[model samples]
Target: MSDDNGLPGAQTRRALLAGAGAVGAAVVLAACGGDEDPAGPGSAAPTAPDGSGEPGAADVVVRAADVPVGGGVILASKGVVVTQPTAGVFKGFSPICTHQRCPVSAVDGGTINCTCHNSRFSIEDGSVRSGPATQPLPAKEIVVDGDRISLA
Candidate 1:
């Protein structure tokens, strides 16, 4: 028998309904089988071998000789700042200021100064040396493997 559209009637309707049901079931099943905890709270966040979140630390390194004596800071990309408070001693911190998370531009004498709000932090220990910033800048671990300086 045919419906008003001049095609199969009940059979076509049944087939169409069955196909839609199957499709719906498949979609539901697929949704249930999603990625299992790609990054859980307990799981260790993926990081470079040096323990830094930045990748390719093994290849990227700064030499102590390049850094100026007394104290000098280099602002690396990705909010990284490498500082040498004294010759042969290097420290790393996030270039972002603790006051308002502004990028620290220069290291004068032994102070890492933030142009934003003039917040100043000691290059020696990343401690807050001036007002507008109560908390110290977050320090990044530094690994001195031979002459190469890698972030940890």
Candidate 2:
């Protein structure tokens, strides 16, 4: 009654479905990867390198003043967290937690926090600060023009 996978009744519909479910779960976990947070601390998100080709007003996400130094402001509607690690320097990152894709709830104590699993990412670079998360938040590109911060 065993099939190639060596499970009893493996030719039955129930057995096939159970095997498919296990394969699907394994694929999901493999995509999530391991404990290494490849984006090391202080690895800044990419920014516009020059003043050319700036995003217009409609792309603007916030005013530079709104994101405080050493902290961040999460724009839920835009799905980004804009952080000012130091004066006049801002970085943008996805607000979605790298662990489980939950929206990060707050930016405080120098990290972007996800209340779901208590994961935290560095406000400066989106690197994991404390985790159940092993990945840094994916970087989001932004342009800073005078006081306007816009998506890029």
Give, for candidate 2, the lowest lDDT window spanning 10 residues.
Answer: 46-55
| lDDT at residue 42 of model 1 (Cα atoms) | 83
User: Model 2: how far is 12 from its true place, Å?
Assistant: 59
- In order, candidate lDDTs are 0.76, 0.87
How many clashing pairs in candidate 1? Answer: 0
* Candidate 1 residue spans exceeding 4 A from truth: 1-58
Give me the candidate number with maximum lDDT: 2
Cα lDDT tens digits, model 2, 1-152, are 44547765656867789899999999999889976655876775434433334536556788898899999899989878999988999999999998999999999989999999999999888999899999999999999999889888
> What lDDT, from 0 to 1, does candidate 2 have?
0.87
Per-candidate clash tally: 0, 0
Deviation from native of the Cα of residue 124 in model 1, angstroms: 1.0
What is the C-alpha lDDT profile of model 1 across 30-140, one tens digit per residue?
A: 779856666765886567555656545544457666667656655557456777877678888888888887788888868888888999888888999996999998898
lDDT of 1: 0.76
Which RMSD values do the candidates have, in order? 11.0, 14.1
Provide the TM-score for each candidate, comma-separated. 0.58, 0.63
